[model samples]
Target: MNIVIVGAGLAGVSAAEELRNQGCPGQITLIGAEPHAPYERPPLSKGILLGDAEPDSTIVHDAQWYADHEVELITGVPVSEVDIDTGHVLLGDRHLPYDRLLLTTGSVPRRFPLADRSGADVVYLRTLDDALALKSRLTENLLIIGAGWIGLEVAAAARTAGGTVTVVEAADLPLAGVLGPELAPVFVDLHREHGVDLRLGTSVTAIEQRGGRTLVMLADGHQVSPDLILVGIGAEPDDHLAVKAGLDTDGGVLVDAWLRASDPHVYAAGDVANQEHPVLGRIRVEHWDTAIHQGRHAARNMLGQDDPYDRQPYFFTDQYDLGMEYVGHVGPEGYDEVVVRGELDDRVVTALWIRDNRVLAGMHLNDWDAIDPIRSWVGREADEELRNTASRLCPR
Candidate 1:
């Protein structure tokens, strides 16, 4: 048997490692579009940008590990096409046949459509190279175009580096789309306390370079000049290869509960896979933890294990003194009610999203000890009296 993995991100690398660990007697090939080895992306906006971590420290595995395991690791080369009928992947002039294929193509950052504007003063934090370039230019006035997780984290890093920071968001509150409007004020207050000039419910209509500085024209007839601008709107799944091969796709590559695509021989995981989650229905998550577990589950199914990827979604973020870990699943409508424990003013709070007295999701801000209990409460009906008890709810 021969296996070919299309991407070398966290999901692809995890699937490759799982296949080897399961003692698969096959030739495994890991192809990466990036020139460098696999690396973690969570720290790119925080630790890496703030000079707390070196680029080499974020690598998933060293060069010698791949050689020792006898896994063929190909970097800097992209697979142009995948021939489902021929059972081969086209790489420029060469083609490699595979008995089983896994696609963890991941996502690409959304870019702004500013014409005639050079990208020299604009940056996006998706790849390591982008992070390194932004890190070098973090010494002056910095303007961020989005108030999502990436933009907020980058704002925190810029402030920590002594750079004048300003954030512009189209939403009325920061993180309103994700965390909902009720909880968005927490983040708004967090940034304000750190001296970040946040302009909410507005957008940049025009961006122009003037005398080495970037002049940003806002929707409210105001102009501000900043040395650099970071755009972090979000990302879109890279599913072009899967779509060309005649596979079903919506926002991402559609996969069943077992992470198998329409074609049994081919499967997808991570950010590129729009999976039918057991609890959340059909959803696509671009989270680090989701990618790791989904990759391992995909590998098991590829090996004929038939295990469904049923884990709840999870993600974390760090900014200044605030550390947050969110678990569970909630749709765009959000929860019916929000239950709060601990003091929000003290920077220690645990908020739960409830629907019909059932805990749907939970978020812990500056409260690391609530992770276990919060996860345990998900999908379970909560007792109002028990949930209200601060002592029993979160035991230290």
Candidate 2:
């Protein structure tokens, strides 16, 4: 039985490892579009961009590991099509038949429209090579197009490197839509305090290149020339292969609670899978933790375990002296109220989101020890007794 897995990121490598651990004696082929081995992406914008870590250090498994495990590792190639009828993946003229197929094909950054048309050399951080290139360019004054997590992390890194950064965000607050009004200001203040020129409630009308310098024209009639422009707005699921194969996709490949796609024979995990969460309905997470765990779970389901993927969404970020872990997910339905513990000024904060009297999400910013209790509180009642949790869960 040959198992062909498309995508060689964290999820794909994880699924390959799990398949071997599960005692699958047949063939296992892992294909990646990037030439490099599977590596952790979290360090790209943080440690890699900051020049604190080497790119090769991020690799999950060296060549020796793959050879020792007898796993077929294919790099620098992409599977152009998935012939569902034939149960094979097409790579140019080659067709690899698979007893089971898993797609951990992550996501691609959303391209900036103005940057492309204006002939401006804008940077987007997604791959290992991208980070290295952006690292060299960080020596220049940077203009960021978005105030999302990636944008902010890069801004923090740039500021720490003594480079000027101007962030233009359409939203009134950085991450206002995701963190809500209560917690978004924490990031805004963090950047402003570090000398980030944050222009909130602003949008870029055009990007122009003048005399070998890039100028960004804003909605408010302000034009600024910067050495580099980076777009970190967000990403979209890379579901072209799945969609071309005629699978159901809503922003991503639609999968059941078990991570099986429209066709039971095909499975998807990681950023590409719009999985059915038992507790949160349908959701797609692009975080590192989600990708790792979902790969393992999807592998089990591929082995016919038929277990539901019910893990809560989890992600973390590090910038300057700040570190945060966010558990649970806030979808389009939103949350009703937020309870704050500790003060943002002190740099140790915890926040809980409640809706219909039930805690829906929780976060610990620079309060690393609060996650266990925060996890317990989420999906539980936010009654009068729990409302007093601020005192109990305050950072030590």
Candidate 3:
């Protein structure tokens, strides 16, 4: 049994490890576009940008580890073509045959056309190289467009490093699309209190280079000049490979509950695979936890185990003094009322999104121990008795 995993990020790396764990003695090839070894990405926006972590600390595994495992690690070389008909992956003129192929192509940051047209040097935070470049300019004045996770996270890191950070968003609150109205305010308040100039309900009209700085013109007719412009609007799946290979793609590579693509021998995971989840419907998650678990699940199915990837969505963030872990999935209009187990003013709280008295999702704001109960509550009725079980579930 020969397996080839492309886009050697977390998902690909995790799948490779799981294949070996499953006792597969076949050839395992992991191909990556980055010249460096397979590395972690979460730290790019956090510790790495804050100057607390070394450049090489994010490396998931060194070359010797792959060599010992007998997994072919191809770095810095891009796969030119994936010939599903011939069961071969073409690297330039060379080709490697595979019995199974897993794609973890991941996502790329959404570009800002306004800034791009202006010819100003605008940066994005998706790769380690991008993080390192932003880290060097931490203390400089930054104009950040968009209030999504990446943008907000970069804003927090810049502020912590003594930089003047201004975050602009068209929405009324940051993460409004993800957290919804009931809990979105928590993030807005957190960043505002931390000295971040958050321009909510605003949009950037234009950006132009003014001498050594960039002057940003806003939709409100206001203008500000900054040393650097960083855009973190959001990210889109890098699924061109799947599309080119004649596989089903809708924003991302479409996969079934088993994490297998339209083609039986090929599968996809992580940010690039949009799976029709049995429990959660058609959902695509771009978090670190999803990447790891999805990779493992894909490996199991590849090994002849028929299991559906029904794990709940999970993501975490840390901004200033606030830390949070959000579990379960709730679309923008999925939830009606939000029940708070603790006070938001205190910052230690458990917020549950409820629709028709059923918990759609939940989050722990500075309350670390509430995640277990929160996870259990999802898809269950959020009655008075059930909502009160938070304290009993986790006493600490």
TM-score of each: 0.96, 0.97, 0.97
Cα-based lDDT for every prediction? 0.87, 0.90, 0.88
Query: Which structure among the candidates has the greatest lDDT?
Result: 2
lDDT of 1 by residue, 222-326 (tens): 787888788888899999999999889999999999999888899999999999987788999999999999998888889889888989899999999999999
Instruction: List model 3 lDDT by residue over 245-304, tens digit each.
Output: 999999899999999999999999999999999977899999999999999999889989
RMSD of each: 1.8, 1.4, 1.7
- Candidate that beats the other on TM-score, 1 or 2, i.e. the better one: 2
lDDT of 2 at 37: 91
Off by over 4 Å in 3: 391-396
TM-score of 3: 0.97
After TM-score superposition, what is the CA distance of residue 362 in candidate 1 from its true location, in Å? 0.7
CA shift of 118, model 3, Å: 1.0
RMSD of 3: 1.7
lDDT per residue (tens digit) for residues 39-90 in model 2:
9999999999999999889999999999988799999999999988889999
Ranking by TM-score: 2, 3, 1
Relative to the unseen true structure, what is the C-alpha lDDT of residue 379 in candidate 2, on a scale of 0 to 100? 90
TM-score of 2: 0.97
